[model samples]
Target chain A: MATVVAVIASTHHPFYYRASTSTGPDRPPFADEWVRKITAFRETLTRARPDVLVMVGSDHFHQLWLDNMPQFLVGKAPFYDANWYNEEREFGLPRMKLRGQEDLSAHVLRAGLDAGFDLAFSNELRIDHSITCPIITLRPDADLPVVPVYTNIFAPPLPQPKRFVQLGQAIRQIVESWPSDLRVAIVGTGHLSLELGGPRQFGPHGPDPEFDRRAVEWIANGDLDGCLAEVTLDSLHAPGNATHGFMDFMLMMGVAGAGAKADYVDSLDLFHTMEAYFTWYPNGVPEVGA
Target chain B: MSRYLVDKFLYTVDRDPELVERYREDPRGTVAWWESERANDLLNCHSGEASTWLRFADDERDALSTHDYVRLFELGAHPFLTLTLFIAMFERDYEEPLGFQKQYAERLSGFTLPYPDIAT
Candidate 1:
């Protein structure tokens, strides 16, 4: 059986690509601190040394549109082209190509279905920044094969918050059941109190700093009951319009398992949104060679 | 009100560099042309299989044609789509980073919570 080496979750701020790379006059004042924090977060994945990554992220009206939106979809292609034209135009993100782990994708689809997920499968998926931002921060080399799982947090009438958690839990079980000898890491990205295209956008801090504080506590401590008790479809809007994306973090909480505190947890309160990073080593932390 | 169609306009225009420019330079003309030529065109389907019943309401058309993002917000157009497309077209005009975005936010500051339903 494949070993579940690590469970990781983060906030995918698209501007990080430009923020970290920009020089001198163009660079944001917070770039150095952001890079330092991301460097420490990157080491968490490095220590786990996983061979394959199961990436969970939400599509932002890119390939998936209102015409044919799926609540939860898995990419089953042999390769995935990362980033989009709009992402390039807006974020200055470089185009990237990532190899896929087809066998695992097949396993996930089959097992995920049997587990009652009704998961949608896409053979050709052009992933956006939700998955790519983590790749840039956690695995800059982008060498490991990945299985992209996209959830619908952007479109209306989305799946319940608990549904996302259930899917994450199922993914953990399904990955552990795989026949491969390779070590696998489940990494997902989400938001913490975000607002886009609304009155509260571009604030000095996330629209609701109080919510961000509580959210970070919930994820870091794996407090599913406390988190779910407060978060609902309608209730999410108060934090910020885009706060529903936090469900992705709830999904990661499911992968980390209830009451299982994260081994490493960190957060940075940036303008617009609160950036967070969490990692858990399911099979105990790995020892690094000198 | 065809919120979906309004979103489709934003989505289609934002993705195409030429359309973004055209929409920026000539909002009324672009909106008029798009309604006739591209509004009914099923995004993922062949042009021959276009939908016949997809057209924007008069108010929606005016909002989009005038680039009235505030009106679009009140009409419940998807905020993310509205923000992204508007940024693409107008962000370049601002001198400072995120200047347009902050101004955009300030313009919508009157809106309270329980924002216009974005459901389609």
Candidate 2:
């Protein structure tokens, strides 16, 4: 059976690439602190020393469009091209190509179907910043092969919040049952009270700092019941327009399992939104970090 | 009110560099041309197999033609698409970082919760 080395979740802020890379006059005053926190977060993954990564993120109308959007799709291609023209134009993100783990993707798809997910599979996927931001922050080299799992939080009539949690739970069990000897890490990214294209956008802090505070505590302590009780499709609108992306974090909590406190938890309050990072070692903590 | 077609215009224009420039430089002309020529064409298919019924409403047309993002938001066009395409075309005009974005927010500040239904 494969070993579940680590489970991680974070907020995917596209500006980090330009902010961290920019020099002198162009750099924002907060870039240094952001980089410091990210560096520490990156070390958590480095210490896990996983052989493969199962990346979870949502597509922002890049490849997937309203014509035919999938609620939950898995990339099974041999390689994935990352970033798009709009992402480059907006965020200054560079074009990237990542090697895919086909065998594992196949296993996940087969097992996922049997587990009743009705999972969608794509052979050619051009990923956006949701998956790439984590790669840039946690694995700069981008050496490890990855299985990209895309969830639909952007499009309307999305799957229920509990469905995301159920899918995450299924992924954990399916990966653990895989026949590979390699160690695998599951990493996902989401938002914390973000508002894009709305009146409350670009505020000094997240539109609703109170929601963010409660959200951080929910995830850090693995309070699924408390979190699920408050979050609903209609209720999510109050936090911010795009706060539905937090369901991806709820999905990660499912991956981490209930009542399991994160081994490493940290968050930074950024201008538009709060950036959060969490990691759990399902197996015993690696000796290097311990 | 064909919010789908409104989003399609924003989606198609935002992805193409030439279209973004064209739309930015000539909003009325671009909107007129796009409505007449490309509106019915299925994005994933050949032009011969285009859809015959996908025209925008008069208000939707005027909103997009005039680049009235506030009106577009009220008409139920997806907000994310509106912001991204508008930023691509106008963000460069601002002197400070996120200046245009801040201005955009201020313009829409009158809208409160349950702003508009974006489901299409």
Candidate 3:
């Protein structure tokens, strides 16, 4: 029997990717700091060596765009490659590859639907930076198999916080029912606090470290409701904070089960963009019984 | 508005009278009322001039709920108008602050607004 061994929620700041491979001196000193943190995190993931890595993150119109977008989508490919946006191509980060867990995707989707979740299934979907950046950080060579779950947290008709928690329960049921001998690690990549575009664009005003600290603290304490309550869609996007991606973290908490404990791994603030990392593991006693 | 005009606009077009009644009763609720009606028409309104109204209907029947319809109003409103109204509303009503309004504005600012061209 395989159990979800670890859950991680962190920011996928493009700045780190760019600075890691950039040629210019304009790259901040903090960029190097991020690389070091990423390297350390990668080593930690490698040591765990889970059979399957379930990643939850937001898609910024990479695969599905304005004309057509699904609220929730699961990837069903057996293997996939990642592409950098038009800007990041100059640095030559080779397209990362990952073995796909079609079985898990199918099971999760089926279980979710059976549990009354409305989700879109994708047999053919391209990997975007949200998935790739963390893949590169955690498994640079991309040897790990992955199950990617996308949330429309940044888009309208965003799933409510309560709904996301329900999603986590649904995922737990699916994982627990699996008849395979596989260990799974779940990773969520997005932001802690920071808005993009508008007056806060790459400025100091938009990144709310106070709220970020509170969120990370609640996760560490296993206070699910406290964390969820603090982040109304409005509070998450308050004037000083623009990053609306923490909903991925909420989903991560759901899958980790209620008593999962989190530890702050790293925090990076660059160009008014704040990125934080936390790793969660299932606690001594499960909150929900089978 | 006359009963005939109301019937023509409401019944002939299949708009919900309850929504129109709410719209007529509360000025602030009118936009939401119209949006709800428009979304209903968009999703279910069939062909002919009436069908154009149903363009926004969900492909799956069970997808839309009363809450979803309300969310569509909150999420789909024009950002500029929403922001201005939100700020005004927040200022007037300090106790029950409108947070989603701000969140919606922040989230949608990046994307192009989806206002349908009335002239078309």
- Which 10-residue window of candidate 1 chain A scores lowest in summed lDDT? A281-290
- The window of 10 residues in a row where model 2 chain B has the poorest summed lDDT is B41-50
lDDT of each: 0.95, 0.95, 0.58
Task: Give the Å error, residue A280, model 2.
Answer: 0.6
Flag regions of model 2 displaced more than 4 Å.
none
A164-271: candidate 2 lDDT, tens digit per residue = 999999999999999999999999999989999999999999999999999999999999999999999999999999999999999999999998899999999989
Q: After superposition, how far is residue A202 of candidate 2 from its true place, in Å?
A: 0.3
lDDT of 3 at A143: 76
Could you give candidate 3's per-residue lDDT for residues B23-111 as a string of tens digits? 33453445444435543332223544333333222311111223222232233322222232233323333443224434444554443
**Which parts of model 1 have CA positions greater than 4 angstroms off?**
none
- Where is model 3 more than 4 Å wrong at Cα? A23-27, A87-94, A239-242, A283-290, B1-120
Once model 1 is optimally superposed onto the true structure by TM-score, how far is the C-alpha of residue A59 displaced, in angstroms?
0.8
Interface RMSD of candidate 2, in Å, is 0.6
- What i-RMS does each candidate reach, in Å? 0.5, 0.6, 15.6
User: Any residue pairs clashing in model 2, and if so which?
Assistant: none
